[model samples]
Target chain A: MSEERIWTAALVVIGDEILSGRTQDRNVAQIALWLNLQGIRLAEVRVVADRTEAIVEAVNALRARNDYLFTTGGIGPTHDDITVDAIAEALGVPVIVHPHARAVLTEYYATRGGLTEARLRMARVPDGAALIENKLSGAPGIRHGNIFIMAGVPHIAAMMLDALSGTLEGGKPLASRTMGCWVAESEVADMLGAAERAFEGVQIGSYPFFRDGRTGANFVIRSTDQTLIDACFAQLAAQLAAAGHDVVDGGI
Target chain B: MSEERIWTAALVVIGDEILSGRTQDRNVAQIALWLNLQGIRLAEVRVVADRTEAIVEAVNALRARNDYLFTTGGIGPTHDDITVDAIAEALGVPVIVHPHARAVLTEYYATRGGLTEARLRMARVPDGAALIENKLSGAPGIRHGNIFIMAGVPHIAAMMLDALSGTLEGGKPLASRTMGCWVAESEVADMLGAAERAFEGVQIGSYPFFRDGRTGANFVIRSTDQTLIDACFAQLAAQLAAAGHDVVDGGI
Candidate 1:
């Protein structure tokens, strides 16, 4: 086994909105992309409802297994926003209004309106938590131990991710290259498998798309080493071209 | 507790593309919506990797708790298509090539390409499983016990869902009404909470959006009873209107 370690993070999407299909979630992709740049792997993601028990269970399970755990949504100023309370329960801690978070909310809401009691709910966090800068909004994110609570909104989550970039301890960042071809993946599955086997440590993912009455797939080669990815991608592209399939460089 | 039972389903999204941030997932929302129409609540969704162990863990954990479990991805004819194998292991059953599935694939591939060994991989399913119709492509979905193994592609999954529509046993379908307003959700948090509290067995979700440099929100009232949703919607609309926030009947 390789001695090199890979840091992994799991995300808990705390919302009834996403579960009910009323809203399409964008946070998963955003967090996944950002985690990759920081040399962290997004290993798992759970979309759980706003229920307290559900949140507590998911948070506890994911945080115990992953190096880091993140939760998006249920941190807003609403009655359904019970992420902090649930997380606190999961961690066996009490919920408290962080002094810094309170001050930030007070200042942000000063010009708009004095922080009402309902709005003040945003200041709550798990006990002994630090604040992650919410460059997009006044309500800062909470980071308790290995768990980071972020906003449900994609842009706000982006800001929180930006604030913590490069701060976490991680191994080599994963690198990937996409090679698309206008042919059915099943037709070339054997060659693709062979290439992947030959390029030890590289993983190739085939994503098929049906567009304009044409069926095609994009094969993604990923590895922690860029050189390995490049070599694998080149071999796959050449194989597809040799098979008389038109190869498209970045995906179709 | 309400006497009416809420049939629940858990989805295990088996894919490396999604976890790698290479593909944006459309399965969760699509399955959630379809399940709602079938009167089954999509209680939770786990996006797991393509690894056999990960798939086995998630499938077993979720299947034991939920009324039905659905999985998407890794049913293709590639080396990474390990969902069927993992699921079979989780069920403690041997994998076998289903006769019906093999016959279907044999006919479908007759015109396209002779059922090559690579293509024959799609016919393999867990023992004692039935096939779900896949209208889009040659391969069919697999079903064993209460678990439904579906295609990762959104449209193909949709076709399988269509074939199984109105076939599952469920109670009343969940109904919802979206009321939008051009005001920060924080501004009306108290009233929204009050409205939700006023209605029994109804839940309200507040979604805030920042669009075109303006802040706004949508309050969604959901319940199994259409009448309950309507009444809650009306009460909330009146409250928001009285508070001087222009309420859009449908979400902005």
Candidate 2:
């Protein structure tokens, strides 16, 4: 068997509103799904307040460990939007006005209203960075080194991820299949453990739910190898069937 | 002016489903709102996979730094539910079956089915830990030192928090007021910054939205002192009105 290399990415959600619970975060799920499509695993996520020190610390720590780092929020046109400055400090670089970003903002704002100084703040980027296309808005996302500074807005962040799709190098995507059963998780704990141990590369996650006065669980098996995933699923399903429980394919 | 102490808590979301984008996390927002009502600030959130080493590291780090640490997920009756063991390792203690938990499970499961060994696993807790009431289910939450181990289910976790309400000591709750305006955040960046600076202890967060083909934003001002929060809101509202923008009382 050949060794498989796993590409991992960490997300830093930079916003006070998120930590304060004023805003429900959708970026983590959105970005995680996007990275999975790119064959990159979203390893960890850190949600920090909109403080320069906090952002810098999380960026430095996550970037050092993961292959790529994606940050959402705090990249807006207000005083509270200080993600660029924090990232620049972490990278030991200076913040500068990117000419392309300036041009984009200037042209886009010309029809609406002239770009004021506050609006021009959206054009600032780290000293050495590339612009990620933002088809929805004029202010493009910033890509400095392996760190992608994305908008906090869920829809705009989705657009940024769509623009950068298939650009990163990654290995085979992880494949997953879910099987649901009406048996309580405790009733099949040993069976699930035995299946996981028997499978060489499959990881199973059991999620229990209480619905309609009945308890059920969905067992998700994940593996990079398709044959291994299929084998693991078949074995687990057979075990459940032998135990006199009906296994639901594709989850309940 | 007297010195004000801030009580802080950090949350560790331990689940592979959340990292895999299979589950949208509701614990962060729910716990943050609950902590705010309890007069404790939700300082940071770290989402990690259902790995023992990852859970141990995050639990130790966050619990050491913050006044309290809350962990959600991986407390179920499956092989993947190793949160209790990992936390015990982090605390340098052995996992032991709590008699009270065992009795609770035995009695609760007697009517439905006998508590088997797998079901009894829920009774295990770190050494010298206390049980938090789980009114919904038989398996109680484990409270070891300052660390709180909660269920992965959203509604169950909410019930656990309700059980813990007003139990922890905290200082004054943070007060906040939001003022909305139909102007772009960039248009009032200076005004918002000035207001935050003018108030001795106020934090202003600008959340912008695009609706009806127009740009708008809501400025949320927060402070421990009600008077300071009120002052900051008034100043910010006056500035927005002076700039020829109508200020919405609650939000746009």
Colliding residue pairs in candidate 1: none
Per-residue accuracy of model 2 over B183-245 as CA lDDT, tens digit each? 878878888888888997899999988887888899999998989888788777877788799
lDDT of each: 0.91, 0.92
| Model 2 spans > 4 angstroms off | A1-3, B1-3
lDDT of 1 by residue, B41-98 (tens): 9999999998899999999999999999999999999888999999999999999998
lDDT of 2 by residue, A1-252 (tens): 123889999999998899888999999999998999998999999999988999999999999999999999988888899999999999999999999999999998898778999889999999999999998878899999899999999988999999999999887788899999998898999999999999988999999988997889999999998899899999899989998998999999
What's the lDDT for residue A135 in model 1? Answer: 67
Candidate 1: docking tier:
high
Local lDDT at A223 for model 2: 93
On the 0 to 100 scale, the lDDT of residue A108 in model 2 is 86
